[model samples]
Target: MKTSPYGAIAFRPDARRLTVSAPSGELTVWDTSDPSRPRPAGRLRTGRGIVAAAWNPSATDLLATVSNDGSGALWRLRDDSAPEGVARWAALPDRPRHVGWVAGGSWVFSMTGTGRTSVWDVGSGACVGRADLTGGRPVVGAHYRGSEVVAVTDSGWARLWRPGRRPSEWVRLTDRPVSACTWSSTMLVVGDLDGQAACFDAEFRPVHTLRVARERPRALACADDGRLVASAGDNQAVAVGRDGSVQWETYLRPPGAQSITIAGDLVALSAGRPRPTLLALATGAELAGGRS
Candidate 1:
């Protein structure tokens, strides 16, 4: 089977559904009931490259995407046909780079290249709040967890804020710029260009740090068992235990991994390869021939 390079990947909250969006704006959903061989479930075309996507926490079939066309859209996937666009908003000053759902999918938020974050009401498709968070630095990545959003900038700063309020928790993660970030139930993990993954508590206190990659980590995901998985571009994908020890590392093909998702005991890596690669989260061994 032929496959285009993927720009981003996401798994449903339940981890049963996986979505991979290509640079051509084609989004494909996969049924991961058998993690080794994910069957294509559905597809949607946005007409522009998707930068990021997030699944609705409460509605499994609902997905949100931020596109290179300076728009954000919500899509509804059906079993019988291609997904439909339920709501879309455009005309932003900068292209949105990251998107996420909040308030149990009642609202959606996106962050742009200029550090502008906008929150839209899903029901009305109206942007209810907008804020500039750059503070003279470029935002590298952002993560939405619960009602709060954390934005990390190239200046090595991370700020936690809620809509209509100033940042309540802010911290300087490192002197080196951060590359990726993700949230677990009780912890926030940030990876830096220095090849380190740092864990912080709820109050922005440093808990521990693990060296996951030789250079920058392209993506980071926290597993259910408190392990940190990181993809280092052109390097390798690694899983680190809670004790700041390396659990396993699997080398990748050139151009390396772009994104990662962990569901149950399986880890899916979207890389330069033709198809996504599946690895055993516990042992880092390829599964089902490693192509899905």
Candidate 2:
């Protein structure tokens, strides 16, 4: 088996490729046409700890990477003319802790630790507008609910905003802090410290609540088709159906699962057991005979 130190993992939207981030400030691309045998394709050096990355939806070859040095850069992965330099970069006042693409990848949004979310033009690297989320509390997480970006504060509040527009429509999901969240075109799912995963409709109305155990769910993932939801905690992982019924649950061995991502019909888990594991999205059956 081959292994390397990776901090985060994301599959391409088409499920044909996988990207992994290393703590040493580099990205490794893997060919996942054969999920059973992921072959390393290439690597991109970003120069610092790569905290987050997002692949453009419309342009599959473009990627955005956020560094620990309070900077963000856009890279054209398949560009042969300039293989070393990035396409664009924007230096911000504070370190961008979270990032995602919006407006069909034409714009990028970044959030900082102090509760500020900034929108940037992908091609020009200009800060188009900013949202002050620090209205007295720090933002714990941020997500996109359709075309609007929602910031979840540590105080159990969620607010929606758009690029170059004012934030509106405030809602509260719980009294405890949210640990993880994932979104669909018509719904928003959040995992809280109380070991409960809640689902909301397009209008932010509570629709379903799922609780498996007492442990906090640190990782959450949702299928793009909005048919499956997955949550991983210290020692267990659970997949739920759209109707809020538990589809399947698997208990991880030892140090337990550290991250999770759902793509197509597979749920990929990065656990502390040295090698990642793949499970069936419908039944949680261990894939590849329990190996990755």
Candidate 3:
């Protein structure tokens, strides 16, 4: 399959669909019905270039993307065909730093580099609420859990906030920049540029920390059961136990690791090389024949 320079890759909540967005404004959708082989399903051309994207939790065909052209677009993709211009539900102002759905796809949330976050009603296309992040740093990523949003800043801080409300909790994670973050059922895992990753419980208590490699840990994923965590960075990848013990470590031939996604015990790590390789989170064993 032909590939481009993608900024982020997102697998649907059900792991049935995959979306890859390039910085050149190309969006490719893949059908992952066969976990071992993902076939390109459709493509959407956006001249502005994508910065970040997220799939709606409850809707398979619905997703949101933030582009460098200072616009955020909500799209309804067709499973069988390429998306056209009309598939865009709405385009909002300012380039979003991160985007995700909230309230079971009832609303869309977008964060900006200026510490501004907005909530839009997905059905009505109305601005429902907005909040200012006082962390004084650009938000790199955010995950919606229950009624609160956990956001990681460029300055290595994680702050929790509710729409239209002030920040309720904040934690200083590291001095080095946070590269990526993932949230599981009971844990929040964050990777940093210093080649370190940390896990925290729901109440923001530190569980374990691991120094996985010498390179920046750019990609991170955790098991839903909170038993394992994995990180890939700078040509090195490792899975660590909940107690911070190394389960496995290997050198990646790729130049860098792009993203990590975990579903159940299966973890997908997308290296800079494009295709994502599947590994067992429990044992760090690469799942054979399941490269997407």
- 1-292 per-residue lDDT for model 1 (tens digits): 0112585688776666777776667777877777777778877666377767888878878888877777888998754667788988872567777777777788888887557788888988777677776664677667765787778776678876688887655578777678777676678777788778888777778888887778887877788546555454565888888887788888876666777877677777776543667778888887644343
Best candidate (score: TM-score): 1
Q: For residues 158-263, write the lDDT of model 3, one tens digit per residue.
A: 7777777777766787667777777777987777777777777787778787765566766777777877777777766687777677888866655645676776
**CA lDDT, candidate 1, residue 90:** 77
lDDT values of the candidates?
A: 0.73, 0.68, 0.67
> Candidates ranked by lDDT, best first?
1, 2, 3
TM-score of each: 0.88, 0.85, 0.82
* Poorly placed runs, candidate 1 (over 4 Å): 1-5, 78-82, 167-170, 233-235, 288-292
Please report how far candidate 3 places residue 244 from its true position, in Å.
Answer: 2.1
Q: Considering only N, C-alpha and C atoms within 3 Å, which residue pairs clash in candidate 1? A: none
Candidate 3 residue-wise lDDT at 62: 81
Q: Can you give the lDDT of residue 290 in candidate 1? A: 33
Estimate, for each residue in 1-292, the C-alpha lDDT of model 2 and write its tens digit: 0012454566667665556666566766666666666666677666365666677778887777666676777776662333244554554566666677877888877777656777788777777787776564666666665567778776667888886677886688877777777776567777788878788887888888877336777678888777778888777888877777788888876556656777777776764332456677778877632233
Residue 12's lDDT within candidate 2 is 65
